[model samples]
Target: MALSKFGFIVTGAGFEPAGKRVVLSSEAFEMIAVGVPAPADALVVARQLASEGVQLLELCGGFGPVWTAKVIEAVGPGVPVGSVGYGPESIDVMHALFKA
Candidate 1:
């Protein structure tokens, strides 16, 4: 089936999912972007988006594999889930950027 609706979840400091969400739409497609303060918060947002008929969901690299799996499970098998990944070359840069 054609992908008409898509959802993307991003993680960062001080982001509130409800207040940070943006939806862009046109006659052919719709895209929803949401920001969460942490990876765990993405689970609820992901499920909510799936329930709202989002055909696919993508998570930011901050979520990693574990949170990606959790989101996939939360949304069940109907909606496809994916996450961004950085290559080895970006490991040090990413670490420096997200270091606590």
Candidate 2:
């Protein structure tokens, strides 16, 4: 997928410790092909990605609740955040979700 200058994509496999081959490039995040387990490392990168102003974050299906929660926690109470499942239908929803 094409990404904006400031956009980035993250998947579950990129967070594996055993598969410590994760890398961020101008193209995309380099990662394992099959499924791999990840814990602390995932959270660490997620935090960094969020801080870097990535416009979109895509999680692998296997990331589960734990990973997503970490992403949310990393995103914290700051910044303009919203769930894509809610549909990016209007600026009102975005404003409502990111109300400061």
Candidate 3:
């Protein structure tokens, strides 16, 4: 399925899921515009998550230019990665990169 803006909402951004109002973390704002370029650390994190039985992986489709390529490479050709964004430009870029 294509990504929706609602799917981009990350829960751990702050409030510890206390079943009440959600509070934003100070660092959440810091990470707002940061480009996540398929960090080497992400591979480690992904592997761990996979081992723990995670069935899906959501990657930021945010502007980092080569992030999608790196993710496609890192996930090693079979695993699926979801890129979050609902904009037409976002979809176009995803197609241009992943389809290539």
| Candidate with the greatest lDDT versus the true structure | 1
Over 7-63, each residue of candidate 1 has an lDDT whose tens digit, in order, gives 999987889855389999999999999999988888889989999999999999988
Please give the distance, in angstroms, between residue 53's alpha carbon in candidate 3 and its true position after superposition: 1.9
Candidate 2 accuracy as TM-score? 0.42
Candidate 2 per-residue C-alpha lDDT over 32-78 given as tens digits, one digit per residue, 9 for 90 to 100: 22223554455555556556655555454335567666766876754
Clashing residue pair totals per candidate (backbone < 3 A)? 0, 0, 0
Residue pair clashes in candidate 1: none
Better of 1 and 2 by lDDT: 1
- C-alpha positional error of residue 28 in candidate 3 after TM-score superposition, expressed in Å: 28
By TM-score, the better pick of 1 and 3 is 1
The 10-residue segment of model 2 with minimum total lDDT is 78-87
> RMSD, each candidate, Å?
1.3, 11.1, 11.9
Cα misplacement distance, residue 56 of candidate 3 (Å): 1.4
lDDT of 3 by residue, 1-100 (tens): 4321111112222323221122223532311111223344355444443444334556554424365456556656445555655677567766786663
Error of 3 at 43 (Å): 2.3
